[model samples]
Target chain A: MKFKIAILGTGNVAWHLAPALEEAGHTITEVYGRSEKNIKGITQKLYTAESKTDLDFTESIAEIFIIAVSDDAISEISDEIILPEDSILLHTSGSVSIEALGYSSATYTGIFYPLQSFSKDREISFGEVPFLLESEDQTTLQKLKKLAKSLSHLQYVVKSKDRKALHVAAVFASNFSNHMIRLSEEIMARQGLDFEMLKPLIIETLSKSLELGAKKAQTGPAKREDLNTLEAHHQFLNYNEQIAEIYRLISQDIIDSI
Target chain B: MKFKIAILGTGNVAWHLAPALEEAGHTITEVYGRSEKNIKGITQKLYTAESKTDLDFTESIAEIFIIAVSDDAISEISDEIILPEDSILLHTSGSVSIEALGYSSATYTGIFYPLQSFSKDREISFGEVPFLLESEDQTTLQKLKKLAKSLSHLQYVVKSKDRKALHVAAVFASNFSNHMIRLSEEIMARQGLDFEMLKPLIIETLSKSLELGAKKAQTGPAKREDLNTLEAHHQFLNYNEQIAEIYRLISQDIIDSI
Candidate 1:
């Protein structure tokens, strides 16, 4: 069930996936990137993976070729890369469709999207990450299931359409939530209060919401519909129209949703 | 430095604070609430606390009397409560000013706002919770400091003006951030995806934001200003105008903020 994988692009996803596959008992046959420095950054983590600085994957004997690039570059990279015959082609993007790899000459085309954010410097527990797999053929689909199982117990067979929703949901959950903290930091900065004061509250919010479910755990003036508190906050934020506007829109959304 | 304390409310704040104070070696002399059941709920956690269904505290011998009621009721209860002379009167509210207790007859007046959201059924680590303190006199401030030190190391002497900003910032950090998750849950539910799938991403979002600071940790279509992905998400959420509007405003704000 092990894969001899060739990862395209030396970005965050590629950096993490290369070593994770190696630790999961798969051999990383090759690591490809435009920059030798980036390619060297990842190949250093593997046992015997050769580094390639070009798009000519023709020499690669990797059974699975993973294009771990940006959503916009998936098609361009897939179109240009030449792979070995009968090799499986995969792109690890939540937003891009499986058909994005149609230009590739691989015998089997599929998607192996890991539904989590990745940073090159941060370490992730691969076992807890959920893998979303999709393939053009049943054989390749089964192959992906076995390959995904080797890395994590959390795996799902999601079509491209539904995966888009998950991708958008992730944007709201991670990026938007982080921005909320950023806004809090900005507000505290104006008052000369240390951002450390908000850390315990931030940690507790996630814990409480996850435990009791977000709806049940929701609180504050907006949730309580306290006009006085909301009005007071509006007056405080009025100096910065952008932040005040966000506060107004989100508070209204919370109220309307309830 | 252990003081005999009397708590005025049996809500979430009172429920948690009563037990936390007792654990810190303070004696809860009396707990007053309109409902006998609510009083018993918190009073049961203390060693020698007496429960009072009525507000009259003429016979109470506690050194510190805490008004842990709602913002609207803080002044009303403070006006009606009969406290012993030289007793420190405090209201545990973030938004309410220390001057709200001006009607009280107690020798010392202050605020003892714990910067956290509490649930009656949930267990909180008091050591991690920050206590925001304010007092009318220097002697009372020192006394409150000693009391806060016994329960938590995180204590700040914030004035009413700056504390309002902290309270509002907390609303953005905890309540608003939670609603973003709720929006994600709703988005997932529409796509027939389990909420459990988003848990790891949600957890990582908080961990990364806290570690790197929120500004450095932000990422997504909006942060990148990727029009293609943003357009795709806009189309997906167009059916619900409220959600679509929230997505639009937050996205635009993220783009503008950068």
Candidate 2:
């Protein structure tokens, strides 16, 4: 069955999600963003949707209204949008509580958090990503579950607290990991090396972690407690005090934990 | 087309390299390690090889002798092992210079550095890794090139200084990235969340980096300069001073860099 969906944001999440939802055989009835220009881009990309900058969502028009806005904007948009008693509402926030939608007029409200970092240019395959879904009511839960199953192979029903936990973990896994790579590029640049050289090692490290859990797969000077190499690397980064401090702090943490 | 090979050192590097060499149709004529127990494992794993725990290596037995040992031990092991005239000898240390093996008895010496972290339990496929090779002599370089080509698809004939750059980069790419995952696990633990929840995001982050280099793919609170959320996270980690400090430092660094 084709479900009618309306998106309520034009950020990275909506930019990626709108197209994916349409590709999965759903009709994007209406698209809303804070700016007219933003809505124009989304509407242009997703040709089948009516675009609006203002929050004037009507009830019973679309089966689902997905608010893919920032963590702070979710509540405001949900509050402003007047939904039908039979419609279901969902937010794509990993941290925000599902109950934020409970006060709205919609019959059902929940979360539809995608557990991955999104960029405008990078096209991610939703089929491989795990979607976290939650609802206070059974009907809302089933509807979100069906929607998630249509896009991704992996789906988990988690509570708001658990979803928050996953969100924090995602920051570490996605955001922090990328920072480390950027740091590596900086460290290599000091030594006159290209960042491309480290690509193979980066790929292997992640693949190894996937094969063995992070706890068991951990290696390097910190894991092995090779104080000599640690000191040498620390000395190498002495010129850059900030990186040196990070080296010391993270190495100490790993050592203390081990 | 089969190259005769002798493996020096029976630690993690030797344990991994020896099997890979044999699988590549190379003849392992001799295996050397400091302890009988160390050589015992390789001998049992690979049949038809003479095992020696002492420094003594037969004269002109193989075309090449690979010294796969600790960075500190590379020079010492190379100095101790007496090889045949015009024989090629290589050490698998990322940081150590190729010139360190110059003082060795072998006339032709080079580096056969594998840019991947090796663990006993984890079996890594050499075909996927990039082997960074360096040699002063053209003949020795040709032999190393052939050997590396047989083992892996990617091979880079890098200089000693360039290899050092790549080594530091590998630390950032592999070691630092693992630390990021560990930090995420730590953060999740405090929040009463399982680290497993972050696995998909971790995989996605790395895959994205591979597709769209680290600089372009960077994202998070730091990248966005969302000080409100940053302050909230810092307040959230008030109980754990060490992690809180790290979170603050890294977030600040990302913000500064951006």
Candidate achieving the largest lDDT: 1
For residues A23-59, write the lDDT of model 2, one tens digit per residue: 9999999998877898887889886798777666663
lDDT of each: 0.90, 0.81
Query: Candidate 1 chain A — worst ten consecutive residues by lDDT sum?
Result: A52-61
Candidate 2 per-residue lDDT over residues B1-258, each given as its tens digit: 679888988888888889888988998988898788889888777867788877666554687999988878888988888777778889988888988897888889899988887877778889887888899899888888899999999888889877766665677678777877876776677767656656767777777777776777777777878887788678776787997898899888888888
Segments of candidate 1 deviating more than 4 angstroms: none
Off by over 4 Å in 2: A1-3, A22-26, A35-37, A44-48, A99-108, B1-3, B23-25, B44-47, B58-60, B99-103, B136-139, B189-196
TM-score of 2: 0.90
DockQ, computed on Cα atoms, for candidate 2: 0.60
Worst 10-residue lDDT window for candidate 2 chain B reads B52-61
Best by DockQ: 1
Chain B TM-score of model 1, please?
A: 0.97
- Write model 1 residue lDDT over A148-183, tens digit each, in one string: 899899999999988999999998888888888988
Error of 2 at A75 (Å): 3.2
Clash pairs detected, candidate 2: A59-A84
